[model samples]
Target: MTATRPDPEIPAKLLAWYDKHARALPWRAMPGEPAPDPYRVWLSEIMLQQTTVAAVKPYFAAFTQRWPDVAALANASDEDVMAAWAGLGYYSRARNLVKAARFVAELGGFPETEEGLRALPGVGDYTAAAIAAIAFGRRAVVVDANVERVVARLFAIEEPLPGARKAIRAAADRITPDERSGDFAQAMMDLGSRICTPRAPRCDACPLAADCAARGHDPQRLPVKAPKKVKPVRRGRAFWIEREGCVWLVQRAPEGMLGGMRALPDDGWSAAGDGSGEPPLVGAWQEAGVVRHTFTHFVIGLSVRRYDGAPATVSGKGEWWPIDRLDEAGLPTLFAKAARLARAASERLL
Candidate 1:
């Protein structure tokens, strides 16, 4: 077992690339300026998990604009926070974000060590390492999807993802520079995202082309991945009745898929069957339509039911809505689909 040193040329090669090609992101601290506030970096990283940079910018700006600090975030009402996070998806992340912010504030601020970061809600090893290295200049290896692709191709590893994760981490650590570990980590991510892309790799323009293992093999074929599990289809019934132009909407439970967002009133859903028990809607509920949506783990089939009578708004701390004002309610995409289906059905019947 020998220690691995950074490639003598890699740091220079990658740093040069980073200087010229770094993505212009709002959360990023300027080159010479002190690193961004730990709260900002940590918060943004947590939000950015499994989400794209372009999708996260406006959400990031809104969150920082409202809270601006860990203490403020910790003190915000769950409703306000959830409302701010409505369109971003992954409501649990928003919930944990506030929880972690409060936890950190109680402890003074974000812990400088990786261990401290790991202890926060939703901050896993990769996230902790990223924050420790990028924000504090710690010599920690950060392996995201982008970094994973770069590492796998550089070493020509063929093992599928998740299983190949450990080997990729080791390889990334081997090449990560100790001095500017932060820049090195960013460089790996940049290289994968921009140059060594998933489909077509720009090997001709890659800075590390000389040492790339996949250069000899096929650059596009080196980083092989396991086939994805087919998302299981699940079914449910959503009641989308409207009264006096105000539609009825209910808040989803504070956990699980589509949590903390306003949605059409629905019965419980399961993988093996349609919703169990009686639905919340009343007065000869009619099957308005069916809406299909796919989640990360499963596909959902929703039976859209509609009721046109007096407004019944007692759906667990939710509100009745003027159907036309649906946009102001901040419904997620799934609910958006349901709303559209129900509205169209109501018009066709009348």
Candidate 2:
């Protein structure tokens, strides 16, 4: 499938718009500025996957401040990185980030090409292209979600996504200029995010408005998406064992859902268990409440049960995390929500 070239003026117009309206992201180097550090670019791109820019900002800042560079990240322990990335969702990305950091550190520096970057863990086509263009000043075409939307709208591509991705990439390739390719890619992203939005696109403010085929049509409907499969709802149970002002928090298995994060002991809830599993302790367990959390594949209702028995008898491969400093334990969002529910129940009992 061949993609027709976009209007020759599109690049210049878009670059002009980008020069004025480029987002002031922590990891981005402004137009005409030196390329951003590859480490920062790589880190931000990994974190930004399926995540919002607003949500990623603090995480980016935190990770960079703590690790500072690829070497530092490589040297950090896996538990520490996983904990820091707890609420960010997608535990695997954090794992891969550490692995890739070690790989890069061993190689002595980041690879400068998309193909080379792709060889690293977690650096897929989009990420490799983004790093190559934005961090290494390469002419690679970078197509992210925002760029996909802008391209789809600009060319009025009507095919549904996943299927339309090929044409979208070709269209993106057509518009990506040889000069300042990184800036061009960022410009398209900024345009899509700020002006050519999913709904109620600001066509009047768009630099590519003159060339956009979807501009006259219902632009919002250009990039049609196939229906999403309904996420299955699952039920589970989590135990809140408290003693001496601290809670029993266990580290998850090294591999699987929410792997390696510190979490409240539970009846194997991570597998979407039927909530019928026995409590870790053999004692009176009272229902604290339920905590609802959504994972990628399923939604779960975790029944928070409190241990009414003596804590001294409960034994496990876990730590006694202070209830007051539960925040520092780096529990995943699901467990974090469960903790809040249990804490409220304990307060009521007090």
The number of the candidate with the highest TM-score is 2
> What ranges in model 2 sit over 4 Å off?
1-5, 270-273, 313-316
Find the candidate with the highest lDDT and give its number: 2
Per-residue accuracy of model 2 over 1-350 as CA lDDT, tens digit each: 98566789899999999999898999999988999899999999999889999989999999999999999999999988998999998898988989999999999999999999999998999999989998998999898889889999999999999899999998888888999998998888888889988889999999888898988899988689888888888788899988888888899887788877888888765544565678887878889898887777888988998874455756778887788988888999988889888888888998
Angstrom error of the Cα, residue 53, model 2: value is 0.9
Q: For all the candidates, what are their Cα RMSDs to the real structure?
A: 2.5, 1.8
Query: Model-by-model lDDT, in order?
Result: 0.82, 0.88
Q: Candidate 2 — which pairs collide?
A: none
- For candidate 1, the TM-score is 0.91
lDDT of 1: 0.82
Give the poorly placed runs of model 1, Cα more than 4 Å off.
Answer: 1-6, 276-278, 311-317, 322-325, 347-350
Range of the 10 consecutive residues with the lowest summed lDDT in candidate 1: 310-319
Q: What is candidate 1's lDDT per residue for 144-249, written digit by digit as tens?
A: 9888888888778889777898888888877787877777787788788789998889899898998877786877775677678887788888877677878777
